[model samples]
Target: GESVGLHLPTLSVQEGDNSIINCAYSNSASDYFIWYKQESGKGPQFIIDIRSNMDKRQGQRVTVLLNKTVKHLSLQIAATQPGDSAVYFCAENIAGRGGADGLTFGKGTHLIIQP
Candidate 1:
């Protein structure tokens, strides 16, 4: 079961623990990646992004890594805080699909911060 009714995977970590969220994209042609964090009633907010040409990119306390060999993408957050509690999603921009805005999103993971 995927954590109750939402059918979303859940990841629980200590309030100050480092957190990593992973996603696997289907299209091998995907060239760009973006990680988003969505809180309880709000829209997904951009966290960080990485291009397929690069293996890793860092922003502030977040790091995004792209593995083209396995079509894998991951977002790592250092010293997670209570504000980090939310649903995290990864979106991919397939090459030559819909110009600049074509993004396919993966099933989100619900990140829960434990006290």
Candidate 2:
């Protein structure tokens, strides 16, 4: 089984700082990945995504780096702020067309904002 739980329950950071969250997936065959941000009770919002072929992808204030060699993944947030405080999730999907429902998500890292 994969590590569904986050190692850190909460991370506190000052405004205008940068934050990094980590996650590990279980399936070796999973080729698709997505990162989502959930603010409290809201649903997860798509942040960015990368395929197995790619090692790195980026978006506004956010970046996702994948390491197929170790099955490890990380998310980097630049210029973290109070609005950026939210629970982040990493999800993996099996590479293929049949697996449309392919989404196994890790627990989540809660980003706390300190004013």
Clashing pairs in 1: none
lDDT of 1 by residue, 67-111 (tens): 889777888999999999999988888665543396777779999
* lDDT digits (tens) for residues 1-115 of candidate 2: 6634356778888888888888877678888888888997899998888889999999999989998887888899999878888999888888683332658888889999788
Query: Per-prediction count of colliding residue pairs?
Result: 0, 0
The pairs that clash in candidate 2 are none
Instruction: Estimate every model's Cα lDDT from 0 to 1.
Output: 0.82, 0.83
Instruction: Name the TM-score of candidate 2.
Output: 0.90
* Candidate 1: stretches off by over 4 Å: 1-8, 96-100
Query: In model 1, what is the error at residue 114, expressed in angstroms?
Result: 0.7
Model number with the top TM-score: 2
